[model samples]
Target chain A: MGIKINVERTSAPKEKPEISQLGFGKFFTDHMFIMDYDSGEGWHHPRIVPYQQILMDPAAKVFHYGQTVFEGMKAYKTPDGRILMFRPYKNLQRLNRSNTRLSIPSLDEGLVMEALKQLIKVDEDWIPSELGTSLYIRPFVIATQATLGVSPSEKYHFMIILSPVGSYYEEGINPVSIYVESEYVRAVTGGVGNAKTGGNYAAGLKAQQEATEKGYSQVLWLDGVHRKYIEEVGSMNVFFKIGNKVVTPALNGSILEGVTRDSVIRVLRHWNIEVEEKTISIDELVAAYRSGTLEEAFGTGTAAVISPIGELNWQGDKLSLNGGRTGPLASKVYDFLTGVQRGTVEDPFGWIEKV
Target chain B: MGIKINVERTSAPKEKPEISQLGFGKFFTDHMFIMDYDSGEGWHHPRIVPYQQILMDPAAKVFHYGQTVFEGMKAYKTPDGRILMFRPYKNLQRLNRSNTRLSIPSLDEGLVMEALKQLIKVDEDWIPSELGTSLYIRPFVIATQATLGVSPSEKYHFMIILSPVGSYYEEGINPVSIYVESEYVRAVTGGVGNAKTGGNYAAGLKAQQEATEKGYSQVLWLDGVHRKYIEEVGSMNVFFKIGNKVVTPALNGSILEGVTRDSVIRVLRHWNIEVEEKTISIDELVAAYRSGTLEEAFGTGTAAVISPIGELNWQGDKLSLNGGRTGPLASKVYDFLTGVQRGTVEDPFGWIEKV
Candidate 1:
């Protein structure tokens, strides 16, 4: 079924922020994509309306039950003035997966993609042209049912908002220090950890705050059950280069299947580099570091394509990787991923979609 | 500091629903209590406003990161027309505990109690007079900062809304069948299971839905690690009567410290009944059932006060407790608790507060 989205432009648009000063998710475009879902009607009334405050009943399930899901993607403005989105379909697919896990209604991926492209076309000027800046796209769905029950909501609202963001690393691709959290667990095998829902992120806030207070940029969470295996770092998937093999935590039931993680694995295989998805415990990592086999470590996500780990503080024992600098593998992965995203490198994997 | 609340009464009052037809959380009162919290300003602008829709930016962290906490309580209209609240201070303390765990700023409990009392007084007419009917109070705090990051929100909105609710069991106190979920875990130790936050509820939606589909009223969640030890049943704390002793899972790191659970323990001890809070595994429970010692089982929460577990389905085995009827102990506890809440019984423990 074709979805006809009604467009309503803003009459009075606000002043655009300076591209150099555009922080993450602080500013939104003039218009946004919205659709409503009822119990029987499914998803309906797809539209592009002027961005404004949303009115909801105070008893909406999102407020009390957190029945919501979200996706993060970006639309980049190429040097030649073409707009490109890196693996947008993967984001949509993961969004539906999240919806399934949260018991929210599924959306037509094809229709949502069409609506997204139209929305980007309408607000194409929002895309930043700076070296690393791009228009961040946030697609989210929230339960709007006005009830006070701990169950899946019968009503929902799906919305897509755009924000012009500056470079993640203001200075450069600097390696960040990480604190390995032993107390707090982000997700468990049978929990909603694999889904892109708010609960998983909310559960990590305390650990993240503690890590920051300890002079760490992020917290590396261990497995929930044993509290031994490395799960993920902050909101990103983590990778370790021990000896010569690039190893990441296998797609366990708890670890999120990040789009950037998948792309990096594909690119590494394309280059014929040995990449393995396996469970690497903290003990193994510590032993590898002591033996001088842990060469480099990095996190992969949309915000920062590849964030190298410089220092790791595991229960007061600190290990500095690659002399506390960005390693060659991390740098290469970052450069290649950003190059492909910005249209500077050849599209060998057909990962970029023109908008 | 004294909070001078601004009162804005509704001009056109809504028609109150029929007392006999008032379902759970179906009808709202005329007014609600609201307060705002800023990063530096602390909590301010306390007010009693007309119950209505709330306006918020789409980028609010509560919608994206699930930074929210809530409390459920009720105002009982006694036979003599006095409004009674059972252990309101305990609910407020638990709310603050939830805030601490979620990284949200703490609220001044004394000031909040003042607001709640004032609001309850203003909407006293909405309290239904029928048996087992009362005015349900929902107090919640949601992160309202218009930013899209997975961290604690700097701005929050604390609101209390009242709903005239009918009895959870409209016919009378009835036993419910429970499904022992072995696949999806509610929460794990070292997670947010102990907190009264939205994320914990959102994580259990899938399992709850599955249990409902399997002809059960609620899902009995086991420990996330072993999936052997009993944790909670649906949103309530579970209790089991084996032989002559009442046993419940101890206050592990993951189980919520339920106010009703604590009260029940107190009342049980007051009656000189043998009660122990310890780890009770499913195997032990099954063995007790086979040995004819599992005499009764019940769930305790604010909503139902006491819900007797008539049948439990663990994998393929089914255990019918008390001949699938409301056990004598559950009946007596429910009557005594409701009697105290409604001012029909003497308050020896001083759990009731008057509005």
Candidate 2:
């Protein structure tokens, strides 16, 4: 990378929160990375500065048009004091992919990688070595143009914020119940569903709130067009095991191409478990449950690498899965992923990058 | 109203721009209305402050989750020196409707109306009295909670910013060519399409940019599920006069319930012209175009009011209407609507509210 990044250390660093008290996305580290993008000048003046508030115009495009994109990743501290990140370059690639769909300018991945490693190095003391704790990294871009027109913004701000966190869920590793959503549609095949943008999450909040009020942990989304095929599980890639076969929805234009989903499939194949990616419908799943073939269901994402779904409530039919317990396969996959992330297990696929 | 609103006037006012140079949304007035909403206190601290930038945390929910809603209205400086707003109470009601969809807290519309009137009084000098000039008011609410959760934020900021503007288009009231977009989808039936939210506009920017590159003024969006029924024309409700009948897309839980759209239908029916609000497919319009019954097509919204569709290019087959000029029905509707807005015609529907 030929770019020069200016680093400004914090004069008065705040005390780090207790590891046990650190929930998700609440406590930020001392340092963060930021850069600005102008229409003609491109991305310039990359800097690692103290964590602070952002002052933007009241009429910024992001506040009005919701033109933004983001990526979620984590960094873990090993017992021997080694720091590791799982497949960060892939996340940068996905971030650029999302930026393209949102009409924001694409960032130089290599240069941003340099900036990220530097920021993490400056804030390395903030990494907690607790069993389930890691430094959650959020890299996002927002439109900064102070214009009200609906076109693409001429200005943008790219930022990376680090938050020390425990598990994403209060339930931790326990399997949770899911509600099969029928009335609300998340994204269509021709929309921005595949892209990890703000709108997709915003669209899912109502459904999630409704399901939570009904005592479900999350809502499983169906396809926007047919409303039959399974698309995702509460912003995560979903998988089901039926009749000794592991199945997940294919990388249709509407569902997100989850990074953890790919890793899980690769690991399962390495262990001689065949994984099939195709259209999965609720009716087919219900029939599988009736035939005693629906063994285990889990969701895969960066926040919760493997969320074992113990039950699914589809149209008032509560189908308890794996006897309301975490399946053996789900536990094995979670252990392998977390071990690789924490550098306890051997890196089989070269997914871990040293910081 | 039992609430108190503090007012703070700016000491040094910036020089106003020339009315001729006051393009759409490019110039802001001196003062703006602001209110804050906390989870426990609800909406409070209403004030009129000088126009300035907003200081927000980098992890504000609006930036990452797009949990926001907005409404657009304008205040016209009538020839009789009275400031008038067209159906502003209706706009406030619609704002609350959008808020409910986005899961934000409902606002007191009556209190907000009082604030709007006060804000207009303080910045009344910025309201341009030139031909085709008025003050554009943008009322919006953005999630301000400094957390990275996918759920709704605990805090919000409701704001009203005014911009003195000229006509929306440099083309004035001339007819524009529209490209029928068949690839990208704006929204779906079960989604936030009916709400006046930011995500809907963000999802359509790419198509609009592509259409502009192809020499079209805007893109005509079809429904997401079928991709054949006409949904909207560049964020505006569309209408077509064919075979002595005026047809617009019905509010099918997908298209927006536009204020201008309702006004156009009422005016048409009030003048004894038959108007129908039903599902109008692209094939039906094309068939009407082939049989020489597609007399006029125009879009209705606050910005453009009445943008006549002179030509429609559907898959390289350009269908010219009214010989690529404004049709009689479109002209009549535009004239009558603008006349009532400017207090030039009788207020038959009582759609105007004097400030």
Model 2 — TM-score against the truth? 0.99
DockQ of each: 0.82, 0.83
The sequence of per-residue lDDT tens digits that candidate 1 reaches over residues A228-295 is: 99999999999999897999999999999999999999999999999999998999999999999999
lDDT of each: 0.92, 0.92
Residue lDDT tens for model 2, A229-253: 9999998999998977899999988
TM-score per candidate, chains pooled: 0.99, 0.99
Q: Model 1 — TM-score against the truth?
A: 0.99
Candidate number with greatest DockQ = 2
Compared with the true structure, what per-residue lDDT tens digits does model 1 show for residues B98-169?
999999999999999999998998888888877888889999999999977667899999999999998665
Off by over 4 Å in 2: none
What is model 2's interface RMSD? Answer: 0.8
Compute the lDDT for candidate 1. 0.92
- Expressed between 0 and 1, the share of native interface contacts present in candidate 1 is 0.75
Of the true interface contacts, each candidate retains a share of: 0.75, 0.73
DockQ of 2: 0.83
